[model samples]
Target: MGFPSLYGGLTCLDFANTVDGRALPEPEEHLHDYADLVRWAAYADLLDTETAHHLALLAKARPQAAAASYTAALRLREATFRLCAAPPAANDLALIQQGYAEAMSTATLTPAGTHYTWTLAGDHLDRAWWPAAVSAVELLTTDRLARVKVCASSGGCDGLFLDISKNGSRRWCDMGTCGVEAKISRQTARRRAARRTTP
Candidate 1:
């Protein structure tokens, strides 16, 4: 589930609009980058999370939906980015919380309670963005503790994965990139050793 797809940056906004035919606002152009994903993730309200979760369900049920879920799945990119970024940004919670205030409500970002939470406008219910938004929150707060693995090449030049190992040490989303590079590097070292021995 960690490969590039045609709909790379479509986003939660795109997923909800595309599936339900209800357009809100488009995510910023650079949303594909990991940082934007982080903002999107924390920005998700309950409505949107549930929507995304159901979409994930749809993708699981209807294989063809995989094409679209690529963009859909990038929301998960938000959770992943949060996991990595939260540590560094932990001290900056006040500013982080300030930015999260939604237009309809000014829910304070506790930012230090070991979890994140927010309340969005109830009007978006029919929009039903809850599923996607909620799922993203769950991942950030409680769900993130679970183990996951993401693979990449020596320079992170390939696909990624969602490995859920118990010990949490799983790496390389796919062997094609990180796995192959390691193998090739080892082989090259071995050949170089053999040449020196023969001389």
Candidate 2:
């Protein structure tokens, strides 16, 4: 009933999925406002508890700034979506690179466990989208492109996901929803065909 996170595995690319079925009159838009964005950040592990609380307070205090952050987040998501959906043209790649550069400019590397991780300081609007942007850039530049997949459900689900299965056969964003529905649909079709062919 709440905002769906079925495709959160893809981080920023998942944000592109907030609004689905573009042709429908009422598309499923998860990021209705700044609060929704924070909810998504929590799901993505982009915001720690302290930063998230501060951001929520900031949103309440400066609604306009919050709106701008939401808009910027959407733009970065779109750029990531396009890059993942296909091989980007020169212009498309340039736009995504520009976004990645901007995000990296505000982030600092901090040692976490045994590896270094990007961390942003304070609760600026920039921080709202920084982690997600960094994640998108990481996925794009790494060797994971071969495993990036768009949902193959016939119900027109446009969820983007990473196919990390052994056989690389992962087709649905979540097996419980679109995958189950598609399986049921296939079984029903087979039964109908069998009945029609019976003597």
Candidate 3:
């Protein structure tokens, strides 16, 4: 339907979260089409409403370019997941480094409120994917990596989150979805175990 909630906290990580699981064969991808991708980008603050509308139209006019951009986004998304989900090996590290290099190449240092910020440049079809790429790089190169966590919910929700909690014990990608689901599941299991023990 509409863009999903920003459960992953950061735009880039949220982009990686367009899918649900890590198991092979078929993770639940939310970006079915270019429009979906653009909508998700807009939700992530990578595209303004006006720019998103223009990009959506551009995607319709130039399907091939749109498809290419979609593919690039997915590749970066996977690379980001690999970087965060576990201790990346040489290849995984290289993929992330390449993604970061690409993002940095297109970025320019600009003044924000009181500090400088990296802003993406270019009016290309793939520009929509840069912000998320930059965010992925930022997360990877910071101390925040210690806070990154995969969801603990069972049944393969497979969401990731930056646990910004004070104690860093925050679990579940979303209390409404995975959180509630896990609670219900634990309760059901306890009930079943009780029944088994009872005559």
lDDT of each: 0.38, 0.76, 0.79
Off by over 4 Å in 3: 86-90, 109-111, 114-116
Q: Write the per-residue lDDT of candidate 3 for residues 1-199, one digit (tens) a residue.
A: 7655889888767887888766535777788877788888777778887778888888889999999888877777777887888555567656656766877887789999989987775456677777777677788789998898898877676688999999998889999988998899999999999999999
Better of 1 and 3 by TM-score: 3
Residue 77, model 3: lDDT of: 79
Q: Which stretches of candidate 1 lie over 4 Å from their true place?
A: 1-82, 85-87, 90-133, 143-146, 149-152, 157-161, 166-169
Estimate the TM-score of every prediction: 0.38, 0.86, 0.84
Alpha carbon RMSD to native, model 3: 2.5
RMSD of each: 12.9, 2.4, 2.5
- Per-residue error for 60 in candidate 2, Å, reads 2.7
Top of the candidates by TM-score: 2
In lDDT terms, which candidate is top? 3
Q: What is the Cα-based TM-score of model 3?
A: 0.84
